[model samples]
Target: MTAQILDGKTLAQRLKGQLQTWLAEVSPQVGRPPGLAVIWVGDNPASAAYVGQKQKSCAQVGITSFGGQFPAHTSQGELAHLIQQFNQDERVDGILVQLPLPADLDSTKLLHTITPDKDVDGLHLVNLGKLLRGEPGLQSCTPAGVMRLLGHYQIPLAGKQAVVVGRSILVGKPLGLLLLASDATVTFAHSRTPDLAGLTRQADILISAVGRQGLITPQMVKPGAVVVDVGINRTPAGLVGDVDFVGVQAVASYLTPVPGGVGAMTVAQLLLNTVQSYGQRHELVMPQFSG
Candidate 1:
């Protein structure tokens, strides 16, 4: 059977519209718009594009964008100091440090500098700990977005076999935890995992977050499994995902497209996290948006 598309772009747009409407109604009472500080460093083209999209999304949803690009030579101490400043800024409800900071800079240290309340990227140890404990906290955007997409589609998770084909803290590891919390039996596979296809074929839900293109082929997928492709690999043709889309589309029952799927959801969830932090800070009741 041909697979159904998950269509995250449409869902993301709907979420943005809801946020815009809610923010328009609440900003007057709040006296200021919720703010997001995105600290981008260097001139990485991909990072620049991502930052622009995030800023544009913030403007659409009434979240003021703060922070700007820094030079590649910008020191770790300088970045840390800036994060501290954003941490203390009352108007800024969320702080995010764009990834792949200069090799010399300590990304972990800089990330930790942002207070847990304002760590919108949810990479801080505190937030990760909260996730480990299954407590309410700002979640890593991509994983949260993946979970949101799965929930939106009403895919069964309880007691199902869910295989995550990556182990990075950002997406794979955390996403496994999310599936486990939903009562899905979760398995994690990585580069060194033996018999990768054998592992994936056993999954009811298959997710590939590893950035390698064409990692998950049709033969690796279980017929009728839901496949979520979180990879964003740029090639001469265009951006593509880990899954062999055309091949897997015929194998898996449901699938997420490369550009319009998890990537769009990531930005949407970042906004959601920021808004959630804002509501918590102001003691305002935030309305839930469901699929």
Candidate 2:
């Protein structure tokens, strides 16, 4: 079967439209637009670019974007203090600290320090535990985006066999929980799994988040399986996913591309989380999104 490409760029644009409408209605009631604060430590070029994209997206949706930057050597205490202040800031609804913090800083402590309500990245332990218990909380953006993509394509997850390759907290674990929540039988696999392709071949729905390049080839996919490529690897050939796109497309019924698939959805979901934070903090009605 020839695969139908899931167009995340177009889909994200549509979601942004929904966010704009909600912001128009909700901001007036609150007397201000929802505010999102993004903090970055170090001069990581990639992190800066990611923050810039997020800030631009916030502006488009009428969410105020506040960015704070620090040197690579910024102390853990200083960072924590910043988070504490943002948590108490009446105007700030969502707080995100870019990942890959410098070696000197304790990542775990930093993540735990953010207030659950303002943790838009949704990495705080309290939020993580809430997700583990299947309670209502903002989910990690990429995993949330994956579910959105599935819903967008109307893929039925109930009772389906799903194989998720990867075990990172950022994507794999949360994704498995979401799939399980949807009643899909999920197997969380990784590089350590023997015969990785053998497991992947049994899945009705396959998701690859392993950062390694070309981990899922056409031979690894079951006939007509739905494939979602969540990996983004920069290579000499440009950006590619964990799945071998060209070969897998020939075998899969539906596939999401590397640059335009999960990546775009992640950015869109970040905006959604910012909006949700506003609703929760101010006791305002949650905005609706058709996307």
Worst window of 10 by summed lDDT in candidate 2: 281-290
lDDT of 2 by residue, 1-291 (tens): 789998888899999999998889878988999999998999987788778888889999899988678888788888889889988999999899898898878888988888998888888888888899999998899999999989998999999999999889999999999999999999999868999889999999999998879889999999999999999888887789998899999999999998999988999999998889888878877746748
Model 1, 227: alpha-carbon shift in Å? Answer: 0.3
Residue 62 of model 2 has an lDDT of 95
Model 1, span 181-263: residue lDDT tens:
99999999999999999999999999999999999999999999999999999999999999999999999999999889999
State every prediction's TM-score relative to the real structure. 0.99, 0.97
lDDT, candidate 1, equals: 0.95
Give the runs in model 2 whose Cα sits over 4 Å from its true position: none
Pairs with backbone N, CA or C atoms under 3 Å apart (clashes), candidate 2: none
Best by TM-score: 1
Instruction: Give model 2's TM-score versus the native structure.
Output: 0.97
Candidate 2 lDDT (Cα, whole model)?
0.90
